[model samples]
Target: MVCATLALALVGCGASVPSPTPTSNRTTSPAVTSSPETTAPADAAAVFPVGEPREIATGLSAPWSIVFVGDSALVSERDSARILELPAGGGVREVGVVEAVQARGEGGLLGLAVDQDRRLYAYSTGGQGNRIQRFALTGTGGSFTLGAAETILDGLPSAGNHNGGRIAFGPDGMLYAGVGDAGSPQNAQDPGSLGGKILRMTPDGGIPSDNPDPASLVYSSGHRNVQGLGWAQDGTMYASEFGQDTWDELNVIVAGGNYGWPDAEGTAGAAGLIDPVLQWRPDEASPSGIAVVAGSVVIANLRGERLTVVPISDPSTAAASYAGEYGRIRDAVLAPDGTLWFVTNNTDGRGDAREGDDRILSVGLAG
Candidate 1:
């Protein structure tokens, strides 16, 4: 239930994996809705029987990104700046609404991308900081409309607590960002600090000529709050760090390289510092939001509610165990037809869950 003072306001005291993040869970399973107006019982549990989880959508509130676009499942709600639009058996809608946020505690309208012409991109926390918007999608088949919302980039740093939003579009189409040190940690080893970095712009934010300090748009730097940003289709990039009670990483993001955070929270000899193929123990895993699927990389653990399945490596390094447990997981997606979408931080205030209740899980990929 977060608030060990948000893990001491973003891990830094004597953490390095000494443990303390997990809280309550004997096993309860049965709470996953998409919330557009959820009707309930389409499917929320099957554990890989292949073709079950289809509760579709139902009144999401703290949903926090789910992605699909065509078959529909577009959720994102960090305090309800709203974006819910889930369809395929039920039909629930709310199309768009993430403009200029400032929604308190962990910021609002948090992360949601739908590129490849589907438009819709957002990474809110605005009111003067942390932004990235774009709507564009009128109406076609199953339904859509959101047209005006543009705003492509802002100061970034809403601070109610490490505002590292989380956006993704990689595969070299560029557009990746995970920023978070906004709560400060020497700005995560400052390299002209973009705040505990991993920001490779250009989807409209521009700053890509192979960026690596072309004036510092930073693609790497000792991170400490980067909330997951996957890319293993052979393009590399795979972050998930959030340790402070000691080690909770999952890195593999090297370009400017240097992920030691506060000098190293997971592992590193400090020669360039970059360790964590998967170290987790900040009470099971504080690792947040991520998805890779088939090649295996699906992480999500907002204070270790569990959902890790590492195994998409090469020079990715370390992490080959622990992949059972799923409750406090905060945002994850890999859907097209491959299936594996998750979202639930129990209202993000810390699980006890409420309001159309958390859910969107449709897992199954263990080949």
Candidate 2:
């Protein structure tokens, strides 16, 4: 095991909300309005009858991201920089560790994406900054090892907090990354700054020609600290962002849309700024990793201490499940057997740790 730094402070910041941009063009009406009782598990039965969350794995420390290879799931531990493989119906084993990983605050190792060819991709913080590295999976379940890692993307801003770290391959076969503002509100609106932006690139880290900006890798800008990225069946993308104090948001990502961040936290119907489809209080929904299940989107909440379910067709009518039942939900992903697998983030030095805290739960959706 390669020893790595373990500075385990949760890296999200809080600031005063800014005034909305004094501009106009778009309608003042919000694109989506979440019902006030979103935190209550009201409409959970309407979408799908979800069973009680079952424990799949335990004793994980700050697990950040998860991706499946064959029947096993590859998970990243943020502080330890260790990649563990959890095979189906078995235990978890440490496969490899990124020695150069600096796991301070919200930095460290985060986000994992596996390609169709079984190649592994990881986002981690290093000496220079946050970067994406690709590796080949060797051997089989319970005996997997990562081949020599090749750095594909680099030069992203890194901080103790606000290090936006979520990566997913879109339906278009392109790689997409969600980055934070790096604690700098100004970076959210700056086109030249990679901070506070959603970047789209090819598997080789090359700029895609279809990007709104030809010369830049930025797909959308003005995001405060986007942590969750999910896609509906039709390729429509949705992202969850951490707001400065008052609000958190769920946004429908457009090619070049500017999600008003520092200038507007939640719903600002000003021109040139896209409003969030749903908004919540930071305490009620400090949302993180999100996944699309059936026709609804499932979100993991860190501070809200619950799992929020939002239907893509009508996001305004949202509901919650297991509110305060689990401690600080982090990542949620769909399993191959029509189950939902997610991780808890209580062991990251913030929440109240339970007896066997920081676990992974598997839930089945019925009807």
Candidate 3:
């Protein structure tokens, strides 16, 4: 949403990795690592199982995100500034589109989620700043009633590059928002600041009354460009984030937890900060959207161009089993047919582009 770019003096100039994209597809490209180790098996490909990822739709302009509504509702798209619905039988049509959104480099519609009530949410970097808006959907795979977007919260740092804007709802039923540093590394450690933090709020554009700090909107801090978030069955929030070059991470989030981002990279734990449940080389896994299913955490990689499934049995444990190589995966979710539905950003201006490279793909995994 915000499109906040880091300052040239801070760290935007001589860049090593590519920037963060806001929509479903971009020519750009980009998951994670050893535990404290959560992974599948030594022969992960053999242990969990796999399926072919076919191009379910084509001619999509940078499809950035994907979310399945109920058993038949499917929606996806990227910087083209539109959310398209894919019917169960076949065919596609526009469900809803943001009219005032000005599409630019790495900015537009990015993240999306369908609540238990069938309401849809779009996280978009618009003309002003990144904001979350709600939309109504029909059971026939059609969504309408583009209601007024109530600005539940605002004033996120708008970085042209690292404006992290992934939003999710935890099992607790509270809406969670992931925001980047707005390019300011200093803010990552500042508990008072909202940038580079995971924010918790109510479904109706309101913050919960029982948040860690009554006046604070930030749930956790010390994140660089947190793009992906999912909740474990035990209600543990696992957030996937981008690190400098050495340590990208998958953190187990607790309310009011301080993850220690720019302060520390990988698994090093500070006195008051929590360490990552898993860490990876930035080049190996620039993880974006993440989905936890059955007993695994499925991380969608942006730069590494792979999807990694880490297996775990319970919380309180430190290690997890890992395995996977689904390339260029971005947004991912468990489909109704016991499959993992994921989207690709192979054409988002970063990674290698194939014919119909930007597509929604699904792979079978044990339910």
- Most accurate candidate by lDDT: 2
Over 30-119, each residue of candidate 2 has an lDDT whose tens digit, in order, gives 222442111213333324327677888898999989888878999999999999999997788998997799989899999999888889
lDDT per residue, candidate 1, 200-313, as tens digits?
888888788888877657888778788889875546667887877766766667677777788767664445565555465676667788886545666777766766555342
> What are the models' TM-scores?
0.33, 0.87, 0.82
Higher-scoring candidate on TM-score, 1 or 2: 2
lDDT-superior candidate, 1 or 2: 2
RMSD of each: 17.2, 10.5, 9.2
lDDT of the candidates, in the order given: 0.66, 0.79, 0.66
- Models sorted by lDDT, best on top: 2, 3, 1
lDDT of 2 at 329: 92
Tell me the tens digit of each residue's lDDT in model 3 across 173-204.
Answer: 88888888877888887877778888888888
Arranged by TM-score, best first:
2, 3, 1
TM-score for model 3? 0.82
Candidate 3 runs further than 4 Å off: 1-49, 74-76, 142-148, 314-327
